[model samples]
Target: MANYFVGDIQGCYDELMQLLSKVDFNPSRDQLWAVGDLVARGPGSLPTLKYFQQLDGAANVSLGNHDLHLMAVHAKVKRANPKDKLEALLDSSEINSLIGWLRHQPLHQELPEHKIIMSHAGVPPQWDLNTLRAESLRVTQALQSADYVENLLTKMYTSGSNQWHLEMGELEKRIYCINALTRMRFLHSDGRLDFECKVSPAECKDPDLTPWFALEGKVNQSHTLVFGHWAAVMGEVSSTRIKALDTGCCWGEYLTLWHLEKDEKITQNKLKKS
Candidate 1:
């Protein structure tokens, strides 16, 4: 069976279907793995969630920052941003099941046989593969727990706490791990995750900031890192080991699909909102 890695769909269900059609994707045979942000900021959030929700064995995804925020909104921890066009999704009868399925998705997906790793954001330079698996699981288990909103997600909203400290309590620790997996973009010279800088490296004037993939002495080098997020990067990075999949479809650009076995990329431009 052929495996395809799609970029952040972000509720662009029409483009997703078109991309799948382009590949002649057979749900019974081929598999689609999304980098996440399966909902939000596009015209088709409800149907997009429903499509994957029912696609079952043919589809899988990692959880993105937006996806987590959706859960937070459902749990009354955060208000939904109207700009994201999630009204239909939030109002839908199936939102509970949809969010439940989304919460269960992992933050990172490992393709050990291919020596590749996929996450909403790339793996941190300081974390080895084993650490990625372990830390991600901790958050995953918390999300799956019944008390997640009250016990875990509510306390995770503190900002600017990117540095991982040995003395950190659960709140700080979970925030750090979540940021590394979801919001990370650049890093300070000291290798701390930088959540504020959203510009591409060329536009970034800060000399102290380095793209995470450009950092030296990173521990997880064995596996190629595939990630979506940091739409500003627009599928460009310093090395072959790093693949930036988000093509800014939500911002009037294109949706990208990475054909895994062939190492080929296919793209479909975002259609105008009806």
Candidate 2:
């Protein structure tokens, strides 16, 4: 059996299908690991969710910011952004099941045997694999709890609160963790999240801001980090330990899939323009 790690699909169902076909993926024999944002911005959000849902045990996902937004919108905690094209997904009769499945997905996934880790955004520089796993579990628990929509998802929308302090409450810490693992892209020199910067490192206006993966001696060097979520970077990072898979499929770019064992990359072009 082979393992394939795919980038943020972002509701590009046709591209996903074509990518699978290109790789000749076998659901029973090959495992699919998706770097989240499985829905949003493209034309087939509902179909994408349904297709992944039906994959059952063969597919594993790390939840992305867009995926969480869909959950919040479904729970009426947030309004659906029209640009996301998520209305069809929210209107689906199986919205509950879809959102439930999404909530159960963790913020990070580790393939110890392959020495690879996956997340929507790169893992925080301060967090090792063990800490990442533990913190991800905490977020998962909050998301899967009975009052998840009102208690956790609703409180997680506000940004610019990325710093973690020892005296913070459980809710505050959880929100911070959520933002760090899902929404983070750049970090200020003080290690605070730089949410305002979305351009490539060289193009960034703030010289003090650095990409999360570029923090010197920060990432766990033993394992390779595979992630999506900063489409503006266009799958470029200076570190050998970092692999960026988000080639912006929903924005009419290529959908990338990395084969773990073989270290091979297969891509499929977008079927429609954004």
Model 1 clash pairs are: none
Residue 252 error, candidate 2, Å: 1.5
Superposed model 2: Cα runs more than 4 Å off: 217-219
lDDT of 2: 0.86
lDDT, candidate 1, 122-193, per-residue tens: 887878766778789989999999999987779777786688666877667778888988888899988788
- The stretch of ten residues in a row with the least summed lDDT in candidate 1 is 214-223
Candidate 1 local lDDT, residue 210: 90
TM-score of 2: 0.96
Residue 150 in candidate 1, Cα distance off native in Å:
0.6
What digit string (tens of lDDT, one per residue) describes model 2 on residues 204-263?
Answer: 888888888888534458888999999888887877788899999888788999988788
* Candidate 2, position 184, lDDT: 85
- Score each candidate by Cα lDDT: 0.87, 0.86
